[model samples]
Target: MVGTAARALIVSERRITGLSQVVIADLVAELGPVWQARRDAELCDRPRRRAVGAGAKYKLVFVDRLLATLVHLRHGITHDVLACWFGVDRSTITRAIGEIRPLLAGRGCRIAPGLRLRTLADVIAHLGATGQTGIIDATEIRVRRPAAHRRGRNRFVSGKSRTNAMKALVVTDDRGRLLFCGEVRAGSVADITQARDAGLVDLLADTVHLEILADAGYQGLAAQTYGQVVTPPRKRRGKNLEQVQWLMAHHEQARFEHSSRRIPVEHGIAHLKNWRALARHHGHRHHLPDTIRAVAGLLSDQQATHKRKLAALPTGQSR
Candidate 1:
């Protein structure tokens, strides 16, 4: 976690020191077509570029601006607050977020089984680290008007909260390589429901063999799907000690150890929020979950890179 001092440093640097303007301008440049479309669509500015649009009608904005703006909204900052953060007009943000949505969605990179295999080689590294396959769990993403919030009506949930929200399913190997990211759906949906609906079973059947460790929420989903998993057993009435212990080993020993290591994955979730800068936990915020998942995947990538570098290091210093 970034300390209060670090956060203050950041806020002061951007807001008080007048870095907001330079950064926002840089972001508008970095995000390319995504920001450009937003700029033109919003009539943000008419900066001249030499045939930069190709056939497109907009000039580009930086990814950093778009990301920073997302962070502002996540923190529950108002449009005016965001304008203050960026040293721009409040309407610019509404328009930028409006245009940025489709840009991120439309750029969706489909992960074929083969790509999963290639990108997630580190799951095996995790298994080697611990004696378990991997862990699985589902989390809900709270939304405000999720129905009208995201582009797809299918992804929103109106029943889960006082407002709306979405549920996300994630699986990571023991070491934290995200194996799968199911479609974002409304929070009203059950974790298991989204797993099936999201096609996790199909993906596992075709491309994976490691056991999945999950919480009680995924009860029976393992057997129903792949006949594998190590989840904590539920304590029900009429069960004796032997029965309880017997129930425990459904990947019991491994899952316990798995949880010891796996619980840190929640930190990844926390890390995402740090980056997102959200205000309330639940909002009509649609794309934040996907961005968080993407960042998690990038974590695995980074770990893989770091590991390779370490492997190549001199033997004694390797860690």
Candidate 2:
């Protein structure tokens, strides 16, 4: 007889890990060999007969250990609960996460898009080769408020979100494939500032054309420098939007069209937040960049796999 927690973790992966069985199996195939190698090296480094309680041996198999850590990440489940489910001590779950988190993050970096825009030409060529038109936006993740005595703590308060949050600039292709997630910044930082700091505005007008789709929050940002910056028309302080449009020959309908086009990036951001860690972060804030990168890569791989499976189907059938 299997326990409820065990059944949830091992049998219904999507319930506990937020990933389908097929994807989990694929991940094991990809990460199993490296994990085994590391485990073997650690075992070799240990004494033949260790001191009592210096280290307790792991009870679960390699696959279960990996699955346990992933479930913790996806569901933000407590270690004590995980220990009960896996029939291991709480410390074992902690050790597993300590070892596996970095591996998963490293795997994420491999699939993430590179953003080395050394020159304007590089920006143009990179975007052209990877994707032509893309959306740029900022997302803020909520975090526990730091104590008042903590230095530089005030920087994390975001007026926009009205909470203590960390912000990141996210860029994605028209298809919603994540291109890059900028380094985490204090939520007080503006979206345009994040983009400029991340070199999204490094392109020169005289060079190749780069179309960047952005929301109204990023108005008047390198409008002349970058090939083009598409943003919605902003209303003047004293005038209504309709009046401003009528007086300035601006069409409000165009703004609606622009927003319609930017929806995919919004969906991408929502997809990244599905892992729950981003929903409410309780860990070290510094680890967020790695976590975001890892999730993006996993999503990209999952999407690719879905496409491949769809392609294999017969012409008359639908997935």
Candidate 3:
């Protein structure tokens, strides 16, 4: 019965993932210039003597191929599968992706340049009436155990995957724009500990009352920074008046507003999941960090373009 139930859940995951991919593809399309710019490095880095196509005849639209790769990635498909679908070798797919990532950043996607994603207020304003506070937290990815891996460490597991792996601390703003991501760490790392180590708390503290909202994983961060936290109520032996108010939903209106504020982060994650590079990272020792930097950088570029387009749309059409 347990095995049967797990299969059902897996099927459901596959069923709904199509919606996620469509959303991801549309999002990637907005950053056409970003991908086109990387064509040279991506094609040149290939181990082959001949290009996929010469000049414009056999050329693939960087954006379309990128979208194709994203759809294939949604299922944790292998590079072999990706190569077959895209008519390239597994290594070619990998190299093309890697070479194109950094350019996606630094060029059109410089989020605050010297600083991490711009101020929380700036993010909120861009999200507009649909958003309120900045939500910050880390998300994890799963990987197969290393061959040399052994022992009771098997007790450490993730709900995301059946294999062994670690986590990356993702600090995102209210709209789900990834502001920062920490170095990969063991999944066992505590949220608070990772948050601090990743410098999210420091960023929040730099501003006064900017309202850093997160799940309960962020203990005392809200009060310490004079920001508001929106985690669900925690079950503890005791509670003080100050803490109680923070726990209360206040009213139906407050509840709706709270839900809206956190929507971006969740939606953003859904969007990121479309890129296989971010979702099922095999942690290709060499490609891991650079992949994260490129993909995250590309996602950020797409995000800014999304905001810009919405701002240009008639107010009635934007929502």
Predicted candidate 2 versus true structure: per-residue lDDT over 1-319, tens digit per residue: 2255665557465666766777778778878899988877877787768643457555776677778777777778878988887787888887877777777766542222233232324434567666578688889999888987999888999989789999877777787866665467889999878777765555434445667789988887746555377788665442687776574554566777889999989998998798787778887787777666566656666666676678899998978
Number of the top candidate by TM-score? 2
Clashes of each: 23, 0, 0
Worst 10 residues of 3 by lDDT: 14-23
Model 3 CA deviation exceeding 4 Å by range:
1-77, 82-90, 102-132, 148-163, 223-260, 283-286, 314-319
Candidate 3: residue pairs that collide: none
- TM per candidate comes to 0.57, 0.80, 0.57
Error of 3 at 301 (Å): 3.0
The superposed Cα distance between candidate 2 and the true structure at residue 166, in angstroms, equals 0.7
lDDT of all the models against the reference? 0.51, 0.72, 0.54
Scored against the true structure, residue 192 in model 1 reaches a CA lDDT of 71
Q: lDDT of model 3 at residue 231?
A: 58
Tens digits of per-residue lDDT, candidate 3, 1-319, equal 1134533343345342333333345445555666655555677777866665565452334543554444444455666765675565677666655544444333322354333343334443433333445566566766556555566465336544545556665546655777654355656666776666655555555454446567667766656556544554444332788666655635435646666676777776666667676676774644555555555655665566556667889868835
Candidate 1 whole-model C-alpha lDDT, 0 to 1: 0.51
Cα deviation of 219, candidate 3, in Å? 1.4
List the candidate 2 regions with Cα displacement exceeding 4 Å: 1-12, 38-57, 109-126, 203-207, 235-249
Question: Best candidate, lDDT-wise?
Answer: 2
